[model samples]
Target chain A: MWDYSETVKEHFFNPRNAGAVADANAIGEVGSLSCGDALRLTLKVDPATDTIQAAGFQTFGCGSAIASSSALTELIKGMTLDQALHVSNQDIADFLEGLPPEKMHCSVMGREALQAAVANYRGEVWQDDHEEGALVCKCFAVDAVLIEETIRANGLSSVEAVTHYTKAGGGCSACHEGIEEILTRVLAEQGKTFDPAAAPPPADKSGSAGARLGTLARIRRIEHAIEAIRPNLQRDHGDVELVDIDGKNVFVNMTGACAGCQMATTTLEGIQQRIVEDLGEFVRVLPAQAMPQTTNNQ
Target chain B: MTQAPAGIYLDNNATTMVAPEVVEAMLPYFTEQFGNPSSMHQFGDRVGRALKTARQQVQALLGAALDSEIVFTSCGTESDATAILSALKAQPERREIITTVVEHPAVLSLCEHLEKEGYTVHYLRVDRKGRLDMQQYLDALSSKVAIVSVMWANNETGTLFPVEEMAELARSAGVMFHTDAVQVVGKIPIDLKRSAIDMLSLSGHKLHAPKGIGVLYLRRGTRFRPLLRGGHQERGRRAGTENSASIVALGKACELALAHMDAEKTQVRMLRDRLERGILAQVPNAFVTGDPSNRLPNTCNIAFEYIEGEAILLLLNKAGIAASSGSACTSGSLEPSHVMRAMDIPFTAAHGTTRFSLSRYNTVADIDRVIAAVPPIVAQLRRLSPYWDASAGAPLAEPETAFQPAYA
Candidate 1:
């Protein structure tokens, strides 16, 4: 239930191109049964035109992964090999409308398998043994190229946005600084300027009439509570994030550790209430129910 | 919601409703006999005797030498943790531990934690049908290995492990062995005296008893340390106020298990087999998980490959069938089951895995209702699936040749 876009759901539920080609020139297989996802691609190429005449795939994965594979297949079907080669993981993500942050790897897997398949067809070796580029995210096997491409395609303007696309800053957050560097480099290459002085000031700090002192204090108090509770939440398979502070109504979104928890409402009432109460009665603590639902399974 | 006359209670592996007999046995301890077992009054003595009797019942079920060896714990998790911590503590110098990868989280998560603590942990891989590699297990065990913990039967697959062989190997290595018998305790015959297992854990709710009560058996003369440290409850092993009511219920559950085991196993096995065969014949790509010959009599793990397990479970729940998905735990991590991953089952298959564990109460009519209702559900989910194109194959598509890329 990761709030998959309508398009993503459409492709996932009734996917296009989900079978094997009868006569195919090149095929690529990536991922493993251990990795919890696997993609097998078959392509029938018109060698004279160097264009794919037919394409099909079978994916052994979840809804998102399967959708990514289906999208990848549809994108490249009946296209020239060169055109197919330009189809990036970002294109896959975009075609599906958007994927959940963690699930960008599913699109990445689709892209990698495609690239590998093309490489296999051409009998060409990859120029760089880029394995030594440094491990960015060990859990998901994400690397520098994946992050750079994700940042460029998604228009990731911040460290947090980069995390949303490539999951580079998601796990452990040990590599946040490294991901920031990569993001900076990608943005710079795209001629997007980043200036500390030019950065917009915090909207809350603008001291608008809508911004109440109680709300600001409650927000800060909730932030401290979230930070304190973060580790325990991670252990319990969930996480929390501050969504918004509209006057005295403090809104927070719960994910990972809190999602699907029977005690989620209790956690909000008990813990969030204490923070708001300490801030003052002018503040009202509320879970951000209006936010897009991101439950793991719908 | 309109309630349907207390719907037929199957799915015992998920959890069993507390038995009325067990409830009757527990009623006195809740009110009249409310004194702490440690109190000096005769009221305390009465509750203390209840605890002792419960311990003896559990011990008798396992065929252990003494009731002193059984430790009453809060739940299966605590019992598992106690056994593992004690084993690791006793052999501080030995850093390696061997265990099956298909164990429940109660054991597997502890192994993961121990691994993070710099202990060398070997996960014994299983076959597609979820049978452990005995040769790999023997090869993994050594003088460096302190303990080997495996489940008596898999919760997801219901595949019975070769515990007797595993215990023998551990015994020969002079390493302590523990088995989380939560799923297998009442369903399968377990004789601690005959087997080389040093420790075992069982939960009360998995059987016909109440929750919040569990038994952890330690072989006599085993070098073990207590996990909890406080008052002299549980013979200084688990030092918490005894849940006297639940303990009495658990004892009654044990007696029921012993009396009904034979008839229950035979009847439930037949129903389970009928359910399995009906599904396989009716639904495309529907197959049972684990070694069919070595599975529990009252459980069936079926994978209807294109659909998600949660979706199917939801559909089943709507149809008044209480089934479980190994993929969807109480915690909302939608990752395919670790148990299925350990068995090297493909994620598509793993995502589709659904467990239906039966009990003595389930009947052939219940199985028939499931069989009648399930095919349509599977078909509906498949219609939503990108993978289940009928043109692909009627049944038994070649796995290797099945990966067709739809890309140009």
Candidate 2:
């Protein structure tokens, strides 16, 4: 459980200005039920003063989210629309005394809603054409545009921080790689470089000779290694065929003397070690009988 | 000052208060009987006797034929690891595992690790009611499977799985079967002699015993490998000196559980039903999450539409009532629990799921307090919710493909 501050709990329990202003002129809406949080900010602006006369919110989320939205209303009220535009999510969190790192997205939602409200007041677009960007987090419905915005706004370098700021990688985590890619690109655009080492090891697509060989070529290489070792195995009246190759897995069928042999494990290990020595470290040779083979052998 | 006031606790599935008898049973071991059971002195003799009695107590509760079959470990996770890893090590030829998608993190996370280590894991799916498909399970028990590990009852939903029948099926296929019965041990009756479960895992804390102690029940002559290899504690099946105090407490807890088992099903079931019925009557757009008739007696998982759970929980906390949620906000994740997601519960409702688990210590007044405190809270949150439609009993703007089941 989070060690939420008293102020946060108070604001969440008894939120100030917690309903849509029926007579409000400028309105902003962000997030969705699918994202697990949403906020609708209604602002009544005094046209003569160009200031926010009243602010109200309808939030669909957690305690911290409601508190953030409530805090946003208090912070932006009685301020010029221009001044309210500069109220960051950090400022909302600060008003609540603080939010948990994981709940920081609640404050971010408040900031986004404020931006949208101000944009509506100015009759300007709040963000780029979000539809043009591809969806990155299907679970939260967070798209690349939102991910990039959060990454740049917070200078986020890690997937965890991105989740806290935008809730992009906080779901099934299937979109972490996509989030990392966006973070790298956005940081690069800002003339800042993310530490690649801090990220998960990239899929081995370095095009090194051993790593780049096509599946058929890799299979051929394994067969060649088997041919070299066949003479020694034939001395024991045993011959092995390349039954299948699946990623790092190499399936081999041992016939004649090797079939149902008591030394099958030893021979399989010997064959696997020999392949690793001849082919690469990623290769793992197993007896075809050990696992049901997915590939057919000629 | 931020500490929550003493209040009604309906989150027993998360952890239970240590029973007074269990605490009394453990007090002696902490000071008077502090000797290591492994030592060759008189002090060790007394400690060893206490350990034996504790094992017997747990054995009696589980209806295992012998006390020696039980091996104590640090917690449920350790017990689960010890059993599953032992099966893999004992049967090195088999490379496949069978488990459900709704298992606790102790089993799910371990299966993920095993998969990374090249073991194929077949995650059995559950129906909308969170019940397993028998045909899917039986078909998964092929010759390639080393072990079948499934939880007896789901922690979040309280839905019980047909583990005894599943274990029998695995036994016929010559496959090892293990059940993480941490949630079921105290609440339900378990007889290893009558069941085909080769191994079972139980945690002390879930059964009113203190934390830091768990048990792995291995049927006699079951081939096994120790997860922690060192000293000859637990008859060489587990290493390191015994946690003498917690072991004694667990034994006392098991005895208490066995004594209260009948009342738990009767009185506790009554209290749970009262809360469920009351809430359903008071709150609009609320429904149960699992097999209503087949779940554990003390558990009730209800989902409220149009309002998230954390907001509800916070209001409840202010009212001096405590519960838990499968909500993304509570879990510190962007999605709700995997159990709810696997059931394909509508995202709008899933985010609002809350679990109220009761214990024997609770009273009817506690239930009454919760029933009264909850309706107003839900009403307030719904009023503040943008999706809520006061006239219609649903969200005003439901997602395009929320997958609302007929029952929902």
Candidate 3:
């Protein structure tokens, strides 16, 4: 089961604006029954002030889609047309506390319908169609621009947040590394940098010169060498992620089908040791578990 | 979850409980009359007579002219494979097969594998209610078509297909026709002699007999090949040890079906209708799938648009009410059912599709329990959704019409 947030669950169960509108200003219908979910959103707009006076919806969908419509109605009621138009899918998700990463698209659908409804009210087309952009998640039809924009707007601090916003790396997970790279590039473009060196140093480092390769220059050298070896490991049905470096011990996390395989220890001993040796004898390569559980958990 | 005093057996479509009469008829086979039907001894000859009597009972139920046409197999899937493979083998020159989109996986997957092996396979589309398009089916049938396979009734939606007409069309084109009548047998009348159907398959479990027993009826003079190759247990058509006990049980079950056909048609239909109407009326946005006019008297496929079928099934199981989902086979994938997709049913509604197949054991009270329990569960799942806001129930004005030309 998808780990739906309490707020999402609350809105789903007790949806605010369910049913059809009797006399509404503009209505929008998005998605199809064949597509697995459909929504019929009706709005009663105040023509004098151009504000949404009332909203009602009749959705033929799952709990998430219904809740998304319900949350959308609640967000738009009493708000001006412009305010309602700016009510992003992210805002809807946040308003509902949080939604399952996969069902985030349902919230996005709600937002799309709202924009289309508002456009209908203005008697104009809402043309945000940048179809030529690179596809971010093909399964959900999400694009790269949308993912980057969502990340920037939401202050997403982790890969999980990016998943919640754009639904990237959720399906197939073949694009997880690409999503991570895009996220990192987006963060860099925004002048935000993540430096592992900024973390507090470990306290129990009382060892000889062989174990005391803690100089910043040595650390940078090891980082460069590990980066060079990363691609080769990835090609051999494995991935190497930096856990944390404490003194001469360079910690890396191996993943994929290799994570818990019988060959994992051999990989660490032979493959990882050779890479570490290339960096210098001072550097000791270790698995992620070599560090204390509490220290690594962070 | 309310626990019943005894374990409620609600998955009747999967298998059914053996009626008392069927069990009594099989008692002698398990003990007193344990003899090989093929043996030359007097005891074996008596067992052979019993087998002949059973064959006649099966023939009478199916409305077939002769008992020789009915060839007993080990199971439904095996019978289905036998029918399709036999058609392909007999007409080796014709490498094309045509079937409907809503056929059970037993047929659909086999056709798919055949396509991978350089054979052309056409899957005719079905409407939203799971009805096949006859014109499209007829168009797909050609001289190159080896067989045209279609199900008599859909297991999920209970929608009846025009099998007789389809069979006639296939026969006119000199192609074989097969129907997996597993869901329809004993529930509806089937006249094999009157229809142009060349082969038909039926399973024992669906009609309250033990599993591992099935029957395939091949029309006389129809070109065919046996699927199995070993000792000739089923007249060299199916080889291996005979499931004598289960076959006896199935024969008795067929007898009971023939005796109780009239009452089953009326009573089960009434219970099914009541269940369908009650659920639709009580729940918001709930609707039934399949042709309302032509359907199984004891089956209803409903979509309570929003809640997942697994959640509903779990809740129903807790309440001692059994049900199945159209998306049950594709569970964990979160994809809407392939059947619903082919029919153009919306994905949101497709995930919510549930099937309730009734039997003689079900009562009006059972339907009432289902009607009472399902709405609340739908409401509960809807509440957890971010899409619905319960507090915003105030009425809104109707939107002005923005009518576009219907053709455009």
Candidate 4:
């Protein structure tokens, strides 16, 4: 469970400005029932003053999400639409002292609702639903446009970090590659490397989580190295299937013409060298047939 | 603004409080009787004797013909992994696993990993009331299947499965059968001698034992291959030094559990029913989930429409009540529990499920506190909910869903 702050708990137990604002002119809806969370934000804006006279919300999510929405309503009530538009997700999280990295997406949802509401006031298109060629995560319906914007705003550098911010790769995990591409491109634009393995892990009590992530990152690097070799094999009407990665051994299957070819040994050596170069660690690429069956399950 | 108050635990399905008697039974092993059971010295012999008694105690509870069938492991996950993996290893030709979608993660996750390792797993479906599709289970059984692992009781819904019948069907097909009876063991009577169950897995913590001790009941004469290989611990079925203190605690806990098993169906059931009825009577649009008539006596899973479960849990926590939920918010994965999803519960109620699992330790006061504390919290969250407005109109359950099953 998240170690939520007292203020977060306070706002959750006693939310402010709940329900639809009476005679509200601007309304923003974000999230969906299928995604397991949704928010409807209504703003009572004074046209003459260009300020939000009142704000109310209806949120269907976890405790942190509810608290974040409550805090967002409290933060935006007295601000002009222009000023409220500048309220970042970080600001919402800061208002709550902090939300767990796993729950930072709640604050992001609050920011998205604000942007959508302000756009509603201006009669502008606020794309929260899936757009043509824009959806990146089909499971959660997260879009690349929103993913890019969130990555830039939060300075997220890892796929997991992006998930904690936008919930892009939190479901099915098929979109992790899509999220990784966006994170790399955005972090590159910021002149930063998207390597969470090198960065200090968030202050979670699970002290070994950072080292565990390092292992995961290394495994991902190994998988990518094999992927890079796939095109080389595919060009010759043959394919290599990654069977298993057991410690320093990378078990793979060379199917099609490459299966029993005389050059298989040299090919395995080449793959082994590529893995070593890519990971800066020793590893042997052995054929799947050579994988010993004695390695029992535990 | 008030500090959290004294907690009334109703999350026994998650884990139970260790009984004081069980703790006392374990204390001497931790401090004085510390020698290894395998050691040859007198101190070790004494501990080894205790270990034998512990095994018999566990055996008596499980009603296994022999104490040797009980292979102690680190936890229920290990026990489950051992039973399933050993089944597959015992029959190298069979590359498939048959299990239910509503299984605890211990079995479901292992099956998933096995799938990646080139194993075909058939996750049989469950109906809306948490009943497994018997036709689906029968169809999924074949020569390619190595084992059929089903839970005796679901952790979330407390709905009982027809494991005895399932085991019989599997045996006729010449396939091994295992039941994750972790939630069912102490809550109900088990006479394993008369059953066709080939293996069973259970945890200590679920039945008032200290954590880290579990039993993988491998029926005698079942072909076995150990998941953990090492010294001849658990008669070469499991490895590593025995968790002496916890094992002793589990033995005592099992004995105590056997003594109070009847109370679970009576006293605990009464408290559970009262809490369920009180909450449903006052909280509109709330209905129970799972097998209505065939559920465990101590579990109540209610879905309060329009309010998210985490919000309910947080407010319940403030009221000094402890329960669990099937909502995605509580799960590490950003989806509702697969059990809930497999049952095809609508999004409206799926995100709103709150589970209150009781144990024999609970009293009328605890149930009364939960009953009194829950109605307002649901109301408050509903009032805060955007869908609850009269103008918007709360999305009510279909008549079929609102027909609360015969369950608590």
lDDT of 3 by residue, B371-391 (tens): 788787877655432244435
DockQ, all candidates in order: 0.08, 0.20, 0.09, 0.19
User: Can you write out model 2's per-residue Cα lDDT over A1-298, one digit (the tens) per residue?
Assistant: 6778988988987899988787898888876455578788899999899889999998889999999999999999999998988887778888999787668778878888888888888798776233213467755556677788777775667776676545566657898877877877887898977775685323233244355667677677788878877776675467888887777888889987778765566567667755765565557787777555354341
Instruction: Assess candidate 4 and give its TM-score to the true structure.
Output: 0.76
Top-DockQ structure, candidate number: 2
Number of colliding residue pairs in model 3: 44
Candidates in order have lDDT scores of: 0.75, 0.84, 0.73, 0.83
**Per-residue lDDT over B146-185 for candidate 4, one digit per residue giving the tens place of the 0 to 100 score:** 9999999999999999999999999999999999999999
Expressed between 0 and 1, the share of native interface contacts present in candidate 4 is: 0.43
**Tens digit of per-residue lDDT, candidate 2, span B1-408:** 243576999999999999998899899999989998888999998999999999999999999989999999999999999999999999999999999999999999989978868999999999999999888888888999999999999998899998998998998998999999998988988788898999999999999999999999999989999998888899899999999999999999999999999988999999999999999999988999988879899999999987899888888887888899888888776667888899988777888999999999999999998999899999999888877654554556553333221111
TM-score for predicted model 2 compared with the true structure:
0.76
Please state how well chain A of candidate 4 matches the true chain A, as a TM-score. 0.47
* Cα RMSD (angstroms) for every candidate in the order listed: 12.8, 17.9, 11.9, 14.9
Off by over 4 Å in 2: A32-35, A123-125, A128-298, B1-6, B390-408
Best candidate (score: lDDT)? 2
> Which residues of candidate 3, in runs, are more than 4 Å off?
A1-298, B1-3, B6-11, B27-35, B40-47, B328-330, B392-408
- Candidates' chain A TM-scores: 0.46, 0.47, 0.48, 0.47
Q: On residues A206-261, what C-alpha lDDT tens digit does candidate 4 reach at each position?
A: 23332434777778877888898877666444689888888877889999767876
- For model 4 chain B, give the 10-residue run with minimal summed lDDT: B399-408
